[model samples]
Structure formats: C-alpha cells, structure tokens
Target: MANGVMIFMALYPLRYLKTKVDRLGKADLVYLLTTSVISIAVTAAVVVTLQNGITTYLLAGVASLAVWMSTAWWVGRSRTDAPGTRER
Candidate 1:
C-alpha cells in the first residue's frame, strides 16, 4: 500500500492533467503541474519524517485519495453545458 501510494503520488498529476485538459489554459496547467510536484515532494518528506509505520501510510493514502476524488468531482462540475445536465 505504501508503494502504491508512492506510485499514485507520482502519477496523480497525469490524471489531473487529462481530466482538466479542456478547461485549464497552458499557464494554469503549468502552474498546477509545478504545484503538484512540490506537493509530492513535501508529502514524501513528511511521510519519511513520520516513520510511524502502516497507520501513517494508510492515513496518507486515504487522505490523498480523498483529495484527488473530491478535486476531480469539483473540477468536473465547475463548467457545464447546462445546469440540468447529469454527469455521465
């Protein structure tokens, strides 16, 4: 699970970039990409410092996954063709 979270931390931005490709401008995307890199680095450092074993790993994984899912949903809803339209 820790390895999986590390992989996710690395690849998460690709998922974000693909999802927001149509909405974000190049500058905005670049900025977001930079931030994501910084965030991953910070998370890695924090995880190393915690050294608390599985509990910390599990919590970090869950927290990161939750943030990703919520952000995806939020960005997906921020722009729409119609208010009555349902998400596919």
Candidate 2:
C-alpha cells in the first residue's frame, strides 16, 4: 500500500507538469507542490481505507498508472484538436 501510494506521488507530477506546460509553456513550482500535497493526502486516505495486502498495493499502482496515462492522452488529444494549437 505504501509503495503504491509512493508510486502515485511520483507519477502525478509528470502528467501535471506536462499538462501545465502544454497550456502555459512552463511548469509552475507552486502548482507542482500543491498538486503533490493533494495527491499525498488523497492517496493516504485511499491507503487507509483499503488496508489490503501486497497484491492490492501493486494493483493500486497499476490502476493509477492507467488512469494517469489515459488522462494525459485525452488532454493531449484535446489540445491538438483545439484552435491555434499545432501538433508536433
């Protein structure tokens, strides 16, 4: 569970940063810190609620990765389709 939560903590910043960069062209440190803190709090609540075994922990990480990737893909797609946004 802890490992899963840690993975969540680590992976979110990349997506958040990417999204911010796509929209703003630069990553804000305050935004990064705030999101990281929020992610930690939410993950802690989830970990406490689940209270399961190692398999659950691993599964949590996998699930989080999937969600993050899908969200990133969606955001990227939307940006490409938006007016004035060019595809690289």
Q: List TM-score per model, in order.
A: 0.47, 0.45
lDDT of each: 0.54, 0.54
Q: What are the per-residue Cα lDDT tens digits for candidate 2 across 1-88? A: 4765676576657665434554423334444445455555555555677878776566555655455444444444555554456779
Top candidate by TM-score: 1
The C-alpha stretches of model 2 lying farther than 4 A from their native spots are: 1-46, 81-88
Write candidate 1's Cα lDDT for 1-85 as tens digits: 6676666666656665544453332223444455455555555665777779877776666655555445544444454532344
**lDDT accuracy of residue 82 in candidate 1:** 27
TM-score of 2: 0.45
Model 1 deviation from native, Cα RMSD in Å? 6.8
